[model samples]
Target: MKTYQVGGSVRDELLGVEPHDKDWVVVGSSPEEMIEAGFRPIGKDFPVFLHPDTKEEYALARTERKSGKGYHGFKFYYDPSVTLEDDLLRRDLTINAIAKDSQGKLIDPFNGQDDLLNKKLRNVSNAFCEDPLRAIRLGRFLSYKHISDFSITPQLKAIVKKILDSGELNYLSSDRVFAEIDKAMQNHFPEKFFNFVVENKLDKPWLKDINSLDGFSASNSDLRWVELSCLNHFTDFDQIPLPSKIKKLISIAKQLANIEIDNILIENIDSLRILRNEEDIMRILSLGLECMDQNLITKIVLLYKDIKFAELEKLDPNERKNEKINLLKDLVSKL
Candidate 1:
């Protein structure tokens, strides 16, 4: 069997960035043989295995043919005869299609290195138009540090526009749509993800509420979510099947966003100290009260830190809360 390092790790190495994760593509290997060699099967829709020792993913060289619609409608074919070139041809971008041999030699099947040098994002083959999610993924790579500066060729943009017009994006599941957005939120310039979608008018069905992210500057995903949803952009927030804790955070952020800063009560501030993350919750409240002076935000974080100073473990729950309420009164008076 011939195993080669492929996909994002290769692309990141070409760009001089150290990759955090690595995936392998095995050519001339079958599932039975892989099992005999101690590789654990993991893929549900494709032939992917995990190395016995390292536990890294190692997928057999496979080719996919479009049969219907959406991400799972493709029919994946894998066998010992599937060439490395066949697997690369089915990839989305040329940069991602390159592979590295076990002997430290690079394989450039579609001239991905040339496009890498030109700082261009181009499709590997015509199969790129087969999966509509690539359009959103393009926006994802556009938000990162290295690929963020790379130019999307007009040819690829036209393909994306074609995919958008084909209505295939509507077939994407809500979870998949949010998955892309969630990953983009971790990028260096995540606004580029939303900006690209807005510019391309690719916000139909799932991302319809994404209009603009003009003044957003936070790199924290929860902060990003609060900022975006508070402005009514991530309107699909309630339907995204996120964790219950995240839902509570969104609910709290919404409360903070619409609350009258002048009429803000001590109870509201006191309630914040009970949440899991006092710092982020207070930060969200501070963002909501943008008209307040910068001194107030700093003081608010500091004051909330001390609201639970006394050992209320011995008192009744109601008295403990009242104690917090009284302390909050003293704290807000200083503000």
Candidate 2:
């Protein structure tokens, strides 16, 4: 059996970028053979094993044929006859289809090296359109390489359009869909991710609410993600799968943004409970302060810090609530 370093590790190395992880393609190997050779099986859907020493993944060379619908519809074929070139051809993008041997010799059966140098994201074959997840993955790659001169090939664009039009994306779960989106958000220019999804017409029901919002202008990274989360109403807020803390912050920020600045002093600010804990208050206040004046936010936050809720514990529970509201009103009046 021969092991060749494959996929992004090889592609990134060629572009002078440090690879984060190394994936190997083992030719002329079976699941039983890999296990006997000391590799531990890990893959649930395909023949993948982890190196006993290094713990890196090494997948048996395989080819896939579309058998049904969505991303999971493919049936994998792996055998001794499946060469490295056959396995490479099954890859989604040309730039990711290259492999490297033990001696560090590059394998470019599909001219992946050429595409990398030209900064082009091209598909290896028509089999690219078979998997719907590739479109989302490509969108994420676009965000990651936003600074680079790379652009998707027209062929791939048409394939993405076909996938989007087919409504295969609806079959994907919220976790799977957002995994790619969250990865893109971690990039330097995350806005490009939303742009790609919108521009490509990768439409889903929830996207309408998000697309309707004013484009991202927030400079703070957390606040930027907060703005994206706030687009949904309270009823649908939990559907987005955000952390509970983020949900609370987004809910609070949405309410804060809607409140008229002039009327905040006169109207009831009782909805905002006596937030005494500095960390919790700061987390919510930071997002809320995005739309309001910095001076006003500072005053409000300082007022929250100054009001000692521990002192209020001596009073009746009902009276304590009133006292908290009274203290907030008094502080707002001063501001």
Clashes of each: 0, 0
Q: Residue 242's C-alpha lDDT in candidate 2?
A: 62
| Candidate whose lDDT is highest | 1
For model 1, the superposed segments whose C-alpha errors exceed 4 Å read 214-216, 231-236, 265-277, 285-335
Estimate, for each residue in 70-124, the C-alpha lDDT of model 2 and write its tens digit.
7789899999889999999999898899999999898999998888888999999
- Candidate 2: count the clashes: 0
Question: Which candidate ranks first by TM-score, i.e. highest?
Answer: 2
For model 1, the run of ten residues with the poorest summed lDDT:
288-297
- Candidate 2 at residue 104, lDDT? 85
Query: Candidate 1 at residue 56, lDDT?
Result: 95
